[model samples]
Target: MSDFSAEETDLMDKHEHILSRRAELLERMEAGRQPPTSHRKQQEKEAEAARHRNESLLQDLQKIEERLKGRRLPAPSLLAMETRYWASLEESIPAWEHFLLGKGPHPADSRGRSPPQRAERRASTAQDRGLPPLPKHRPAR
Candidate 1:
């Protein structure tokens, strides 16, 4: 009461009074009827339906949690997590970097495609891949 302004406190008091009177009227009306009115019964039915819906939702949540128990992965390694974090940061940096630095009609455009393999790498392609060349076929007379 001390926290509320006088006008707000008055409004709150009136609201409480109205609610109490409404409850008393409902009780009196029920006492006069053979059975509660259809409107009251409808309200009660809707409340029960809401409770049933909440229970169904809770059951579904529990089932989903149980299903995930077997599927969830073990705790991730810190090293793998850190590598993914850095990779994602670098991944975004390059997406717009070319435009930011100005692209096209730039000096350094003349370039030639380098050979597929460097001289040192070309000689050991087979050994590096763990596969040697097959024997060549010879013609028979």
Candidate 2:
């Protein structure tokens, strides 16, 4: 048995084998013995196949990267939390406060809030002026 460790022996063997192969390849190049033939169609086919495989791998990597990015998000943003808080407040507005905001004894709609008192006043005023009632909601410009 050699004094060298198993890893060292394996590495040395691999190095020698690589060097031997390199030398043989170099010698063959120098001799120019039976110069290798070029198969253009076969090479093109192999290149196309390799490109397709690379594209497929790239798509898979992109999908995994996007999934990782999605997971990397820590939590709901401050703006989102604040928005939810305000929405809750809007929904929970008391019937008394809803009436106070308007002049008339406004009844709550299906969403539990009456239409703004200004819309009713506008429609009545428009009728008094002998004009068509203005739309409750404005059209986008």
Candidate 3:
């Protein structure tokens, strides 16, 4: 037989209740958890995915390489095309320079003014007519 006072029995009961509550809380916390995957299994999955991506990329690369090989241009024809392109570019330079210097009017614009001058004239005309200046672009908030 054990000798205990009423207060000691009550304190022991409280201690047991606290311990049981702690254990219950711990169990509940772990109940919704999943077990961790093994490292080897996780690594194997990653390696398999990488290999699949590599194989797919390799296949695409091979197809592109084959297509390019089939479409290879003859060196002589390629050189001739490049030569013609450069020659045309060089021929246009003198006209471009003349236009830039404002020595001659552009054949496209009969007003003999460049595009920027035309825009400025339009804006001035609008202002003279008491119309609102064209809305300047504002960035969206």
Candidate 4:
């Protein structure tokens, strides 16, 4: 019984020594390893910076969209008004052409004479006053 007790005590001491040595080695390895907070803090800071950058980019995009909207194509009301004005001008084109061709009523000839007769009388009076006769057709350059 004494021998068995002595052997058990020796084995227990050896086990305790080995456990203490392993604990020391583990502590040294832990000390040599990088600190947990350094890498984590660096990553957290980078994420925060990225978040700020993304927020600024989003704001810039919103501003650009607003500017583009302001500078976009003409509004429907403006286009409609322009279309109405052009239509009015189109409706008046025939009157303008008649006036230019001397086919419209003359203010001085309010007796309601025919346009050709009025033009002929004016041309004859002008010729009688010694003016050169007007060309029947324009000569090509």
Candidate 5:
């Protein structure tokens, strides 16, 4: 009987030890199977988005650099042409004023028909712009 009792005690101890080891193994497996933490997942997503944005910005910068590299500087002839255009404008101002005001003697008196024709064309154009007709004159007060 004592031997049988000892055998039963040993079996119970073995059973308990096995259950404890199984519990430890299951705990480790469950821990290993868990997904990444929410914070870590969010950080990874943000990092990926930032990388894409940075790549797009880099591409845009490269395109701008290429455009700058290929750009041509204006030639000296453009400066000369611009200067002539401004001088012509200064020389023609009296005619423009005469056409718009309609009071000054025809600009043709000094420069000839070209000024009057230009003025007449401008006057007609002004009439077509939906603006009020040019006043005839304010009689000298």
Candidate 6:
């Protein structure tokens, strides 16, 4: 029993040490200082390890949350969250795409229509003239 207690205390101490070190790393990362080569390598390794740890922690958290709620989240609930996320994305797509891809606006049609076809349609449409297009094509007599 004494040996077990000593081992448990050692484990707790190690955990506390790790937590403090992680905090220091986070502070230094935020400071944006130019670290020494070895320090930069160590920080990169620590960040990679922390990312993996966080991913597993997130999965555990989600499982615990589901269990505590006493019911599974419905598919619709997940879908609604996804839809809300995408709705928020609608406003920023153009800016985000421009920043990420360094390209101009997306091509209007995925079907590979010629630019002339798009232009001609735009000219022929009544909506382009600020009035509704006539329903049928007819020649003026």
Best by lDDT: 5
**What CA root-mean-square deviation does each model show from the true structure?**
19.3, 22.3, 13.9, 21.5, 17.8, 24.9
Give stretches of model 6 more than 4 Å off.
1-34, 71-141
Instruction: Using lDDT as the measure, name the better of candidate 5 and candidate 6.
Output: 5
lDDT of 3 by residue, 20-105 (tens): 99999998888647445676689889999999999999999999999999995779989999999999989877777778898866
lDDT of each: 0.76, 0.78, 0.84, 0.87, 0.88, 0.83
What TM-score does candidate 1 get on C-alpha atoms? 0.34
Q: Write the per-residue lDDT of candidate 1 for residues 26-130, one digit (tens) a residue.
A: 989888886558978999999999999999999999999999986956566977898899998787665456545875322222233234445446758766888
Worst 10 residues of 5 by lDDT: 106-115
Sort order, lDDT high to low: 5, 4, 3, 6, 2, 1
Ten contiguous residues with the weakest lDDT in model 2: 103-112
Pairs that collide in candidate 2 are: none
Residues 1-141, model 5: lDDT tens digits = 999999999999999999999999999999778856996799999999999999999999999999999999678899889989999999899787987798676566655656668889998999899889867877897
Work out the TM-score per prediction: 0.34, 0.26, 0.32, 0.34, 0.37, 0.24
Total clashing pairs for each candidate: 0, 0, 0, 0, 0, 0
Span of ten consecutive residues with least summed lDDT in model 3:
104-113
TM-score for candidate 2, residues paired by index? 0.26
Give the Cα-based TM-score of candidate 5 against the true structure. Answer: 0.37
CA shift at 75, candidate 5, in angstroms?
A: 17
> What is the model-wide C-alpha lDDT for candidate 6?
0.83
Best by TM-score: 5
Off by over 4 Å in 5: 39-46, 49-57, 64-141
What is the lDDT, from 0 to 100, of the residue 98 in candidate 3? Answer: 76
What digit string (tens of lDDT, one per residue) describes model 2 on residues 1-141? Answer: 465688798999999999999999999887685444566667888999999999999999999999998885446797789889998878766654767787436445534555676578777888999997455987889
